[model samples]
Target: MITFWMQMRRTIRLLWSLFKDAETRGIAGVTTVLLLSGTLFYAHVEHFTYLDALYFSFTTLTTIGYGDIYPVTAVGKIFTMAYSVIGLGVMGSFLAVVVKKISQFDRRR
Candidate 1:
């Protein structure tokens, strides 16, 4: 098992690489914006707590619908559908970039 400091150092360097790559077109930034947007919308419209809303947003974007929590209202469902559609592409791209960076980091070791 990797120790905490090792993980932290790898995380820092990977994030720096991502930050530099983000200069041209920030898919990561767009993903973050969408996540926050969905979280805020769910929190307000569905009466979810801040943590639940953020959890829902993350699960929805990653297409990992656990079904433990979800939208109840009609407006919430419609908004969720739209949000999912847009978020999927952005999240997928973000994951791809992250995986690429991790591979590069591994190669350096």
Candidate 2:
């Protein structure tokens, strides 16, 4: 448990450091916009609460698809497909930035 906590701390520190970088911040901002837009769309179109919409957006973007929640309407379904494609690309870029930052951190260490 102690080791897990230590690792969590280290990860948090690394993420904080990454956020300090301009490139990382830019990509992260774009990712945030994508997530928020998706959340709003889900909330308005699917009648999901804000929290549920945010949860669905994150899971969909990450390709987790837990199946606890899903779209029933045709418009929702179509929007989801398009959203997934765009979200995945944005997420990929965000992750790539993180990985690059991590590599730089490793090298500095």
Best by lDDT: 2
23-89 in candidate 1: lDDT tens per residue? 3148867877898999899999999999999999999998899999999999999999999899877
User: What are the per-residue Cα lDDT tens digits for candidate 2 across 1-109?
Assistant: 9999999998998989997999989988988999999999999999999999999999999999998999888999999999999998988998898898999887887
C-alpha displacement of 10 in model 2, angstroms? 4.3
Total backbone clashes of candidate 2, pairs 3 or more residues apart or in separate chains: 0
Error of 1 at 46 (Å): 0.5
Candidate models: Cα lDDT each: 0.86, 0.93
Per-residue error at 27 for model 1, in Å? 1.6
